[model samples]
Target: MRQIEYFVAVAETQSFGAAAQSLAVTQPSLSKQIQALEADLGVVLFERTSRRVSLTPQGRALLPDAQRVLRQARRFRNKARSLGFDTDIRLVAGVLPSIGAYFMPRMIERLRQEMPGLKLSFVEGSSSELARQLVQGELDFVLASETDRTDLARRDLFTETLWLCSTPEDPVMQSDAPATLSDLKGRTLLTLSPEFHLNAIVARLAAQAGATLSTEYRGASLDAIRQIAANGPEVGVLPSLYALGEAIRDPHFKVRRLLGYDAEHPVVFYTRTSSPLQALNARLADIIILEKQAIRAERAPQFQV
Candidate 1:
């Protein structure tokens, strides 16, 4: 491809020195490339003398096609840029299963429409596991809870509030207004297993609200808590996105934000400090932000209620 470019440059200028100058390369390098091109094609492409350089008959015959190839290549590049990726980029990304369950489906759909050439294979795990994988160079980036690891660079994507969730027939759903911390004072809160950062948050909120945090039946995932709630009366604390998913899926499901508590956690994207994919990871975060925003818009009524 480069040889063809140099060939065209020399053909246009009809001088080695001029072509080299136009290409910002040494004349010898340009001449070498042209010679190599001719060697590769098995044809003599130039008639050379001290004062002039002119194309041979064979060179003239191939010049038009070579120019056509270069034109097609340019069009290829432009079209790729128009589609949002000039060159294809593949990433093995890690996400927290909690968010992945609710948000990844929409995110992936939007990503396909916006950047078809950006390929991603998603891995789901606890935050610690994801961070370990990232540090060991197993993942391109991770979307999970914030971490203070000196070796990892963190970018704040968004903050999501927590909601207390249960089936509509639960005693706590008797009122349509937002629930108060007082309402949870005597209840047992179902929660994710201690491996999750959310478990600690749930423990803290339980302590503040005078509720019992159930450890005897810790859930392995957010969906596990939802399934557990389906057969029991225990309330589960869930992040806004996951709670929104449950509320939308079941007409009898109920979620209530705490009236006096600001229970939100910051989400982050983590990668190694010296990662070659810094810009690409930032773009991924931007897309996630947009997708989350669209979700917020779509569920604005649920949020408002």
Candidate 2:
């Protein structure tokens, strides 16, 4: 563990003195630990210079695996500390912005009630961005709708309805009132950017409708897309949660369903195939599943699209 800690500190700081200071140890002690580690592995982990320390090619190759080991060691330390006077259990959780705004509060409250010792940190990003971060070990788990479950170990959390929203300030022609694929023929549509999950769905729908949807004012986040839709004649398709609560609250906004697309969108939580945070991730999933069950029982509409 001494060798592991020394290697990580040195790699991160790239200076022996800085690493030593960070670890609250003497420079000589840190150098000895790194030397012991290199000798045990039969590889030169780092090259020492008067000005700066640098990782050897071998060290660069081993950094990620070594970081995982160090992270696991820290998790063990936290688990041990849980039995002591220190009661905090730190965990990092990521989610797409829309769901974080709407569903997260309930799950967070339940999580706090169930695990008072746990301190959950939430990060918001596009699903693809979150997935990349999860793979890079920056996040323990992600709650998002667009992540590919086949490439990751994931659990379905909940599903929401989707809808197309436009401001009532600009009503559609009578032929387009009960909007269908044919009715969208000449209408210009404002959609979310490519980063959003619903963007692909909306694009496919437009293709089937033989309509060209312009994304010049597109945004990746649900909140931004809702705002764009609320401004004027722009039509933005969004999840039921945002369309209903934020976009619809304005009497100027009108909600319409996409003629030929799947109504239910599956939202999920994902973790890497091999992660040290499995137990913590599963605990969070249990809370999500319980909340999902309650929401489904009530049968409330999350989207009207």
Candidate 3:
């Protein structure tokens, strides 16, 4: 298990020094462990050059099995700890910045009220990063988009419609009509960094519309992209809740539904299939879905225009 841990750390970081620092061990110790593991398996696990380190085919094949073992071990430890006299529960969760920005406040409040004995911590990152953390057992569950991993359990939570947002003075906003995909032609589209699922969705929309996605202004969050869109010429692709929240408060921004484009982004909750916290995680997911549904119901009238 220790050797497998060392190998996984090195594989993930792609740098022995970085992996050693992350694991709080000396580089030589990590290297020795990995070397011993390779000897035991009788195969070279990594291709190490001066400039970079990459996993070999043998390592790639074993990586998922290693992660599964680690996840199960962690779950066993956690389960044992939960059998103590303390009835309190601790959960670590991950969420993408875009989803967190809109839903986190409400979700936190509800959790505090409903599950007072629960100790909750959250990490924010891109959807892919969140998924990675979940798979590695660092996170108990994740609120993110659907992932391709078959080892994780996923439940569809809700769908958020994507809207085109621009400064009020932009020609598309002034036209007194909903924007269409073709309306974006030759225009600049700004979005979150490519690691975000929303960015891929926006890029596809741009490609279909014959618009240019601006690589020069990749934003770290929805707010960052929204602020950039307020400067004009460049438009933003935003989720309905974010667009409505911003547009209602800031007269400078205008949001319109996109015509002839499928703009729904499905949000889902993910947990390891073998998680010991499955029951509690499902309850938490239910709370999130209920709150999200309530918000959507209340705000549905505002978006009708």
Candidate 4:
């Protein structure tokens, strides 16, 4: 393994000294490894001179094959690490409160059906909070919205649109047209907590539309926003996943669309970069996506347009 690494490093850098600098090894040590590799393969790999060193014809032919071998070795190492994770190891997952309330059940059910002995624990918080925990390694997986993070490996699980929910009796909602931001001017708009990504989006839109975001009251979960919207004149903004679920459960739920806005969030599973659990995480992400599709299908007649 070390020989292959040394060979690829030198071949890529084209300098034993530079490769040693990058690999944090002595040049003489790197040269010794290369010599051993050449002896094992029975090939004169490089031509050495006072001013320069270059690959021989045999070295040029072997470079690509050596690179391929390095890639295979890396993949083998990753596979072995992933397999090292015990099935009974308790996996800690973080989730946004709103998503977990409705979406987690199907995921947990499916995961358990596949691995009945899998020990699992769930921690619920705002998306930003969950992301912080994930980065700190306090959680194994997190179902959250996009954040300014590049350290984690992410798989998009669901993309959901924002909906303006209100009582049908609200005078503005009596119209046949989709609700526009203009329709919200001077009206009270309920929003999720400031920590939620939706809150910031709603705040920005409210400023543009001349609407007033109810800062004194931010709904902690989508259900809280839905509850207030059910009987109040104040419009609430929430993801379509929750609105669609409510609409299907109670067809009378007042779930309306934004006239020209595609304001949305991508719910993603974020785990450690190059996580060994990625193989398992992929299966979980797929199940969440299917759940999103199932909910959309359940009430497609009203919202699909």
Candidate 5:
């Protein structure tokens, strides 16, 4: 392994002196290691000349395999270190602000209880933004809506229905009957910014029902939309869990299921396909799913009405 490392260092730096400097070894020692490696492989690994040093055919063929070995070795070391009693496991995770509002407090509490040594950092963003960060390696995992992106591996967490929210003075709240999509026609529908999957879903619903989406009242988050809807006749679309958890208790808001409209968003936990944290990520996903199921179970009767 040491000889292979020396060979790789020489291949990368293309100079024994530079490779030795980088590896903190004497130049002659580095050269001896490489010579031993070439002898064992029975091939010349590099072609050396006064002007430059380049890989021989054998070395060119071996470079990719050597890099893969190095990567796997590093991963092994990291996994071992993570298991140490004093090592703190750090993870960066992302979640949709709307979903996080509903479930994160409980989920985070559970994580703290179960994995005391794990240090978690969270970032909230729209589904699209979260997916982009996951792909860019900025996030280890994200809870978001299912997307068409092939670069991410997704696990279905739960599906939540959409609700129509408005202040008591809104016309839709004048009667006990549930409001249908068509009832929203000619009324301003406020929604989160387009980067959100909920925004896209609401846009489609409005288009299908001939309702006008409020261009001037776009919100950056569900809270903003709910606050805006409180001041006027505008209706805001929100996920059922969020509505049940927060909006229902607010006297200024009326939350209702849309009649005849089966609008639901499937939430998913996703990580990069190449991620090394697959097992840990899966465990976290399971925690979120269990918490969501518990919440829904507790709120079932309220939502049924």
Candidate 6:
């Protein structure tokens, strides 16, 4: 079981040293266990060079099963500990860019209140990358805006509306509201990088509006765009969820509902299809759904997706 755990950890971390640190073991022992597991399985699980380690094809094929075994082992241990012993659970959660800002703190607070002994770690990245990590078994649960169905089972966390946001001081903000994309033909826009779904939305919206939108800068960080919007004449397209606090507090920034932009940006909580975290995933999912609705109820009148 330790060998299986070690193998999965190595695969998930992509470095033996990092896996050892995470597992709280020495590198040599972790390597020994992984070697033993490879021998028992009769396959080379990883291609290790001096600088890095990568999974082999056979390793990729066996990774899901190996992860399942480790999860079961963990569950069994927890079940035993529940019988008058201590059952401490460690959870690794991945999150999308925008959702992490507000939702994460609330979720973490709730988790601490419910499970005082829980050990939590978080990783934030693009929704697609986070989804891929979920599929790869690197994360126990992921809060994401887009669901990647490859190897994950997702529960809808919430849906957020999107809008066009600009600095109040900008001349365009004073102009008549844009009913169509073409209204801002030569406007400079700030948005997420091309790899993110929001960037694609901005592109398509521009094409439809017959506007030649030029992105001054593109990145995954919403704060960066907000800063640019605050500093320059760039119009920003952002999720209403992210733009809310700024809009409310800053006199210079305002969000305008994008006409015909009603699309469900489905924030989902995802886990591996077969893992012991399923029950925990369900609990987290319930919390997310409830909290998301509460958030939307307060802001929905002013926001549109």
Q: What is the lDDT of residue 81 in candidate 1?
A: 59
Q: What are the per-residue Cα lDDT tens digits for candidate 3 across 27-61?
A: 99999999999999999999999999999999999
lDDT of 4 by residue, 79-182 (tens): 66655333555788898776777677766676677666566679888877888888888998898886788887888877777778788788766765567888
Off by over 4 Å in 3: 1-87, 175-177
Q: For model 5, where is the 10-residue window of minimal lDDT?
A: 79-88
Ranking by TM-score: 1, 5, 3, 4, 6, 2
* Cα RMSDs, all models: 4.4, 14.4, 19.1, 12.4, 11.5, 17.1
- The Cα RMSD in angstroms, rounded to one decimal, for candidate 4 relative to the true structure is 12.4
Candidate 4 global lDDT: 0.78
Instruction: State TM-scores per candidate.
Output: 0.76, 0.62, 0.67, 0.65, 0.69, 0.64
Residue-level lDDT tens digits of model 2 in 128-214: 888988888898788887655466898877776666666656454223333666756666666667786767777777787777777
Pick out the ten consecutive residues of candidate 4 with the lowest summed lDDT: 80-89
- Taking the tens digit of each residue's C-alpha lDDT, what string does model 6 give over 8-75? 89999999999999999999999988888889889999999999999999999989998888788888
lDDT of each: 0.81, 0.73, 0.81, 0.78, 0.79, 0.73
Model 1 per-residue lDDT tens digits across residues 32-114: 99999999999999999989999999999999999999999999878655443424777788888767788888887887887
lDDT of 5 by residue, 235-274 (tens): 8887876777785566446687776454777789898888
Find the 10 residues in a row with the least total lDDT in model 3: 79-88
In candidate 6, which residue pairs clash?
A: 161-305, 162-305, 182-209, 261-305, 262-305
Candidate 3: what lDDT? 0.81
